[model samples]
Target chain A: TQLLEQSPQFLSIQEGENLTVYCNSSSVFSSLQWYRQEPGEGPVLLVTVVTGGEVKKLKRLTFQFGDARKDSSLHITAAQTGDTGLYLCAGARSGNTPLVFGKGTRLSVIA
Target chain B: EPEVTQTPSHQVTQMGQEVILRCVPISNHLYFYWYRQILGQKVEFLVSFYNNEISEKSEIFDDQFSVERPDGSNFTLKIRSTKLEDSAMYFCASRRGFGLVMNTEAFFGQGTRLTVV
Candidate 1:
């Protein structure tokens, strides 16, 4: 089975602090997506990375896909209270395949 | 913007009872999927539907689970016999089309919280 392993299952940081979460897998993926989920809500798409070694930035959040397409990372610069949520990473083996999701990193940003 | 929507934000049912979760995918989306996340666990893919039939399904989607797109827009998931362990949050997602170049990003619904007693 293809598995995505995420590190630092829980993180709590003060406002203005920076944090980085990782998602790694042994199998290569065609595309990788990042999502943020609030309590009692479904995951909302943050970004999708399709090319290897690709980097995309959204405001204070930066996402990067590994050169081998088997790993990815989400870095939040100067996190705010609004950044607190369950961050998840999911990978698709192909265009038509189902996504394999990581366990996710739950972050709490305190002001 | 258009988005996926699910009905009955929360559902509670007794063990062995049947429950049907409903979802309405984005208007133009062609690929639909069902996923479940147990409390404090990772989101797990259950099934994928396309062309009025199931395109793929995971082992977890056993005989007890079934999916249907009765109408052009509504997608549904029925759990024939719910068990105590079946309690979880179920999410429905849909994408525009399939291809390496086409946009493959999926839009998700708010999800339905199922509690099997």
Candidate 2:
């Protein structure tokens, strides 16, 4: 079974502060995706990193895939209150497999 | 923007009662999935449906759980007999045919909050 472990299960920071959440795994993935979920809502796709060592940016958020495709990271620059949410990392094994999701990092950016 | 839609945003049912959760995946998506997240927990995959049949399922998806794509767009999950522990927020997701690209990202619905009493 493939598992993605997320670090710093919870994080709270003042608005404008920077933070990074990490997702690690022992198995390789074909692609990795980051998602942000607000209370009472489903997760929204933030970005997807397909190539190893690739970086993708979405506004203030930066996502990176590991060189080995076994891990990924999400870095927030100058985070705003709106950036506060449950951040999840999901890895897709292949075309026929369902994505395996991380436990998620609960981020709170206080204004 | 295309989006996955789930009905009965919230449901409350008595134990032992059967319940069916409904979802309408994005029109052009071919892969459909059902997931559940307990309060304060991570999203867990329940089942994946393709070509009008189930392609994969998790251990959590036991005999009590069943999925069907009755039509071209609607995907449904049925829980034969609900238990107190069955309560959770259920989400429906869809993806345009899978591949190793950004387009493979699955779109999710707001979710249905199920509370089994």
Candidate 3:
């Protein structure tokens, strides 16, 4: 079974602080995606990194895929209050199967 | 932008009662999928349907769970008998079509909050 392990299950910081959440796995993936979910809502796509060592940026968030395609990281710069949410990393294996999500990192930014 | 939609945003049912969750994927999407996330837990894969039939399913999709794309737009998931453990936020997702890049980004719905009493 493939599993994605997320770190720092909970994080709280003052506004303007930077943070990074990591998702690691032992198995390789065809592609990896990052999502941010607000309370009582579904996850919204943040970015998808398909190539190894690839980097994608969305506003203040930066996502990086490992060279091995077995890990990923999400970095937030100058995080604002609106950045507070559950951040999840998902991977596609093969076929039409749904994505496998990480345990997720819960973030809280105080204004 | 088009997004996936699910019915009965929230449902509360008694244990052992059968329930059917509904979803309407993006009109042009051909690959449909079901996933659930328990309160404070990771999102999990349930099943995947394509070409009017199930293409793949996860171990979590047991005998109690079934999926069908009755028509071109609607995809439904039925649970024969609900258990307390079944309580979770169920999400529906769809992709343009399975291809080299189609699986890169699968759009997800707001999700249905199911509470089994």
Write model 2 residue lDDT over A1-111, tens digit each, in one string: 999999989999999999999999999999888998999999998888889999998888889999999999999999999888899999989766788999899999999
Question: Would you list the C-alpha lDDT of every candidate in the order shown?
Answer: 0.95, 0.92, 0.90
DockQ for all models, in order?
A: 0.80, 0.85, 0.72
Going through the candidates in the order shown, the clash numbers are 0, 0, 0
Residue-wise C-alpha lDDT for candidate 2, range B11-65, written one tens digit per residue:
9999999999999999988899999999988899999988888989999999999
Candidate 2, backbone clash total = 0
How close is candidate 1 at the interface, in terms of C-alpha RMSD after superposing the true interface residues? 1.1
Q: Return the DockQ of model 3.
A: 0.72
fnat, candidate 1?
0.78
Candidate 1 structure quality by residue, lDDT tens digits, A8-102: 89999999999999999999999999999998999999999999999999999999999999999999999999999999999999999989999
Candidate 1 C-alpha error for residue B9, in Å? 0.5
RMSD of each: 1.0, 0.9, 1.2
What 10-residue stretch in candidate 2 chain B is worst by lDDT? B96-105
User: For every candidate, what share of the true interface contacts is present?
Assistant: 0.78, 0.87, 0.73
Q: Which scores greater on lDDT, model 1 or model 2?
A: 1
Task: Give interface RMSD, every candidate, in order.
Answer: 1.1, 1.0, 1.5
**Ranking according to DockQ, highest score first:** 2, 1, 3
Estimate, for each residue in B1-117, the C-alpha lDDT of model 1 and write its tens digit: 898999989999999999999999999889999999999899999999999999999999999999999979899999999999999999999999877544689889999999999
